[model samples]
Target chain A: MSLPNPSFAPIDWERATPATLLERIAEAKIVGMGGAGFPTAEKISLTRKHPPNIVIANGMETDPDVNADRVLLEQHLNEVLTGLRIVARILSAVHSYVVTSHKKTIQVAQGCLNDNETVRYLKPTFQNGAERELIQILTGHVVKDNRFPAFDGYLVLNVHTLFAVAEAIAGKPLTKRLVTVHDETRWIDIATPVESILESSDPIRVGCYATGHRPRVNEVLTATVNAISTDKSVHALPCIHCGWCDEACPRDVPVESLFVMAEQLKPNLDAQDALNRCNDCGACVVACPSNIHLLDHVRALRQRNDIEWERISRATQARLRVDAREQRMRSDVIRSDTKRTERMQQQHKWQ
Target chain B: MAVTDRPKFQTTGIMVHVVIALLPGLGVGAWFLGHKVFLVVLVSILAAVATEAIGTRSVQTLRDGTAVVTGMLIGLCLPPSVAIWVPFVASVSAIALGKLVFGGLGKNLFNPAMVGYALVLIAFPMQLVYLDGLTGATALDVLKHQETESLQQLINHPAFGLVGAKHFEWMNLAFLVGGLYLVLLRIVPWLLPLSVLLGIAVPALVFLPLYDATYSFGSPWFHLFAGGTMLTAFFIATDPVTSPSAKLPQIIYGFFVGSVAFFIRCFGTWADGFVFAILLANAFLPLLEPKKVALDN
Candidate 1:
């Protein structure tokens, strides 16, 4: 289906059914461009049943250092556009938006758009690209208190993700990604596979927290890789809640509250309202005054609690369904017996 | 056996409770400072931990939460405009000079956070004031520099007798709220802030009639609010290492801090007095050791 002025840069396009979107994602091996190495196809397959109405291209490179999106827009605008169009088409989105900061980048992207009617630009704010926060601002729709962008009819993608989507349509697999390595002193450019990038470079001396893992040539670049070490030993101490993290959080989630809630013996839903909405951005870890491993703890608690709670809920629901089925069968059996008894009595009277 | 066994208090649990008790003040600080504050805090704390690890030449991660506490206190003391590197520097100083030099955490006599703050203060006094202040109004600037003099002349300045006194008063109120939270939570015993307040106040009261009676005892409150007074009360003076462990010694330590703080505020060339007083008190901490109880009596 032709979308009204779809924003894809004019390279190529592929029409994918929900099934095709998943199949192509896996075949292309497209990975999450927002630093996570998760296979894009896996994410697409999981969320395909629930189509997103609004699509966001997250450009808020709040890292203060990394500027790949800015660079991509500056140079590869058309290529990125073609990918965005494909996503919008597949998702059946009403509106597609680009979230970015660099003025020059937005200008360049806009210029390349050739006045595509469906796409608009969102000025970059701190944490502006966080999927949930971006969705809230763009669509004014918040997902279920504990849910994510998928719940709000919004699908948020990074500039890199769009680039990957375009490549996938072109039948190119995701084999490499752009990694910005810089510190108080130097910036280096290297193109290595997702697993090899960490192994190729030395750990940076500063801003390790932002990097998420320590720079070591031997370490594997995991899904949640940061330039710094995330080991408990290297992780900063617990939060003293100086409000720095909450204030610094560009997404404006209560990171400290999430930490406190995770520590509570009995999880109080009201108390943990903050964690339920957390976007898992490492910004809070950066802001914590006590250098609390805030994101780590919050994410761990969220994952653990989410899994346990979901299991219990599913089990309960299954049990109820089984019991209801049994009761209905018993009622049916009694009714059948009553009919048989009447039939036998009528036969005897006739005789 | 006679029922003469004394109950064993859970010291570890008590310490944890003390750390836990600090959360409310922390929450209030976070509420005001926002997420950026957390970033500064985390960086400073990580920097502090790294510094201690590197300084001691050990791979061991410092636990006791002392370095973290120090980094946080320093972060709170610092103005938001402070470069990220400044916190890194302060954290290092707090852990290295303030804590590790004497030993780690509880063994140190001087508050590590103040040491870090003092280091930054020395290195970047200009940066310590928020960007808003350089562009707008800061409480101390109004009081010390006569920023509100034009308005004062118009109203006769009766409320505060000074042009910016009213504004400074509110800033002081914010600090007081921060300070009270610390005290109420028992993060730092009241003796430190109370004694420091008294130390500064009693002298101001005694000298007010002789020096400048118009400013009077209220000048002490102004002094408390003007610069880092409240911050120091909640953060610095309460440094576990720098202050005596014994209650009476802590009171005496606070008294000295008050007196010296008053002296610096009254006679020193600078407007702020916490650092000089803290450093002076740190020197006296050894003399007030618990083992020296016989000498004191």
Candidate 2:
């Protein structure tokens, strides 16, 4: 499909405040198309609060099977670059980057970069594609646990989102996206029923086959849905503890231990580290020799962890309540004893 | 982290590679040991496959090819001189007891082949010995029995060749070459076999100077190439399902297996103590596993 030519309007960069730009982006309804469908406007707003922010146009498709990003970059390089600069202008950032793993995408982006902009190719791996890992790789700054990359002045947005941002500036709505149907790429409308995309009842995952999930009943295409894979089987063998999952984990989670914990459907304090570190990238799933869905196990353990945490919190609250009551009673008894001693002293003096 | 680097292998594919790698060593063994070695190996393979089929009651389970590999390993571990029934019994136990009892394949704690071999060796110690009409004492036997012979004189014995046992050294060399192929293909990690060798060598070297040359416990070279040392290092102890998988744990496990095996060969009556050492190491696997390795980077 051809690129949309919506109603065009010239940009007035001088008048574009960060708030106005965020509003436009919010109106566009853009999100992180390459990864989790987080609201792009809120992400930009978060990064904007931290000045001297660095904007990264994420042109790299981390999924090994999906090359939709490369095609998007090749087809709509202008709009993507414009969208990146719009974010940079919105943040008044120090610099901007256009990072992709594809050689062709790098070449396409490199020519249009300004003096403040840089484009480079990073070797494609699951870890490098992740947000925190990508930030660490590019900037050598580790995003701490429970912290967002925005705290470090890093704004990462997918190229598709940028395309929408530019279109939003030109007065257009985000109605269609590039969906990888089987092997071919097509412009699929937002909220299109997943069943209509592929007629086969054969099992299908809603994302990249390597790391995606089965579509929920009547699930439709959203910004996060990148690929439709139809060849997966629901059946999986028992985990052999081969340690391939451990080797394949980008987050350095001890997946084998987690798998053991998951097998019992109970959360163990022993595997708490693994449960915290795992982001469910599905790298372990791809690496498993037994065709086991290791992510499902990790997810199961995480749910158990949540329940365990709830019980622990309740117990801790009960313990604190008892401790507080004991302290109060002790203080009250001491105060009463001091009053009684004062009364005795008064009586002795009178005698 | 790059899943795309190596491609096109599953349980079936890996077992097939293992079987292919065993060919050179199996060929060398039959060439030196006798035609009966092939008979023994074939009987073991048949028994293991049949047992696996019966245990699971599904032909699809046989497609995994683990039963064949288990049979081959049991056959190789046994002496060719044993009766045909011995091979059958070992193969059955290797599949049914060693593997199937513990839920088969990856679930078993001990090396399947060693479980069967160790059981039969304990039960029928006399039957497990190698006794050709040409020479009764194997290389390890010569080391233990020749009290009057000095180290120099022992080298000239008919059982001894160059730096190792006459027929066994060739088989060991064949197994070593095949093992290197597995390592090169990245089918098996190199740390496992290398650490195992280092484990045995360090102890052998340390004890060499302590003992009198007249009553030497064989040189490090002889220890490496003698008995089932090479086979154990490469094939048996390196089994991923049974052995420790993490780097630090694997090194410790390999070293422990090697040192114990060496100590048993030198002090105990058994000609080769690898089976016991491996099972013992397998027992300690959980303790050796690294608790957690947080990514520093």
Candidate 3:
């Protein structure tokens, strides 16, 4: 496929400082575009202190149904490469890689890569697209227990996100993105209502079916939406306890039990842990024969945990406030007693 | 809405496949046992669906297809000559008491079919016996009754078929084919059914050699193909709701079910102990599923 002509002018890298570029990115309000929606400027600022050793342009669209990243790389290879160079230069990275599982995207990206940039092919798996998993695969170094890649000097940005960065730098102001709507990848502008794009009468999903959220009818498109689907509704059946969800979980979460707990609305501490570990990749949902929406259950459990945590924290704060008042009253009583004793002693001395 | 979110299969679809897989066994039973089997199946299904609808106060529950499955299973377990009302009562009780009272479908602790069969087995034992006016001592019953007969003599008995039991072996083979279809379709896990078969066969193998002139308990093939063994292994005992969900637990549960049924057949009063054996294994499901209690909490 012929590469799309770069709509935005090339960044004047020699004249522009990292701070000015970051400010312009912030002004453009460019987010991660990798479904996380984290602001690009904040991510770049976080890695500024660490001085990144490597920058990875993540094009591993592991969801079998999502092709936004692959299409973006195939159509706008130079723009994505230019974005990667700009980010790498800002981070002062020595090495840079464009990671993808798509053969066509890899071939086209390889042809576009400069001397410093290399194309890394990773076999498409559900978890391999995750920030931490991609970093671990590219660099044998683990991100080290609950820490993010940006904190560890590894700047892993999604290919679509970099394309957005390139656009933002060229003064496009992050208005449009390549979204896969019903398996067909196309450019969709932000703030375009979901109703306009979907022709189907089915309920709208904001992302790929596996990990997508059901959006309100009037909700507008956002930068992070990589895919949209008007899939038919699945009539959920009772779980047959097949343990397929457990087998499909990338994080070894007890998905079956978690589903049970979520259904019963009695999530425990372990269920909370499972919910935390769930990356919302929807692998369990895909593997389920009964068509149980397992990811929805996990999200519900997380929401419940949040509410429970908030309640406990509020109670804790109230108790702390009451304890402080009681301590103050006790101190006042001691002070009054001391004053009374001192006045009596003075009166006795005067006598 | 996008098409990628759609599930590839539905629960109703799985039930439809299960019904399709069961056709071979149903066909064999109708051929050997007569048209009355179909009548029994129809009555049982109607009664089950009606009971579930009444109990849940929702006609929509019928669409899930579980009631039909439960009814069909109870019907399959009954003798061909059983009174038509027997299936109706058994199916109603299976849905109402065995399933609905315990919270319907996935929540039921015991296999509904086994519960229904066990209830009728206790309530109307006389009606269950004497299929077509022949003393309904299934081949296992005949083998159990043999005191001084050698293995060769037992094999030669009129109750014995070419390899296993007369008429019953073919029925078992039919059920085996149906069961295998379910396994290959991934509707039912292979581990549970295989373990259940192994559960019965291994004990019979170990004890078959001990069967000399005076104490012939039948061979592994006889036990495997004998009355209700294949049916219970595939249809009744392997019920996903009652059986253990995980692999290791499923294996142990299957073994427990098989061994118990074999022991009951040998020493107990029942001709085929599969019903009671499956119910017993169902009771142990909580122990096997250690996460169940934690998940409930």
Candidate 1 TM-score on chain B: 0.73
Candidates' lDDT values, in order?
0.58, 0.81, 0.81
Residues forming the 10-long window of minimal summed lDDT in candidate 1 chain B: B1-10
Q: Per-residue lDDT of A1-351 in model 1, one digit per residue for the tens?
A: 234333322333453454555456566556666765666665554444576466677766655345556666666667677777777777666677876766776666665553332344555444565666677777787776566556546677777778777876766554444444332212122232233333333323212344343344544433222232223324344333234455556555765555555665334345345665565555655444344667656766676677767887999999999999999999999999999999999999999
Evaluated at residue B158, the lDDT of candidate 2 is 82
TM-score of each: 0.46, 0.89, 0.88
Better of 1 and 3 by DockQ: 3
Which residue pairs in candidate 3 collide? A209-B5, A229-B1, A229-B2, A230-B1, A230-B2, A231-B1, A231-B2
lDDT of candidate 3 vs native?
A: 0.81
In terms of DockQ, which candidate is strongest? 3
RMSD after CA superposition, every candidate: 18.1, 4.3, 4.2
**lDDT of candidate 2 over A36-84, digit per residue (tens):** 8899999998988887799888876767567788778889999898898
Q: Write the per-residue lDDT of candidate 3 for residues A1-351, one digit (tens) a residue.
A: 224446444458647888777777777678888888888888988877786468889888866477888788778888898789888878778889898877877777666667888898887767888888888887887987678777888888989888878877875656678988887999998889976887777777778777878888578998888888864335667677767788777888889888777777854555676777888887787777776778888888888888888888999999999999999999999999999999999999999
Arrange candidates by TM-score, descending.
Answer: 2, 3, 1
Q: How do the residues B1-297 of candidate 3 rate in per-residue lDDT, one tens digit apiece?
A: 212222355667777877777778888888877888899888998999999999999887788798898898888888879988999999988998899898776788888888898999999998786367443456776877874379898888877888888878988999999889888777777999899999999998999888766887778898999888998888887777788778899899999999999999888898889999998988888899965543433
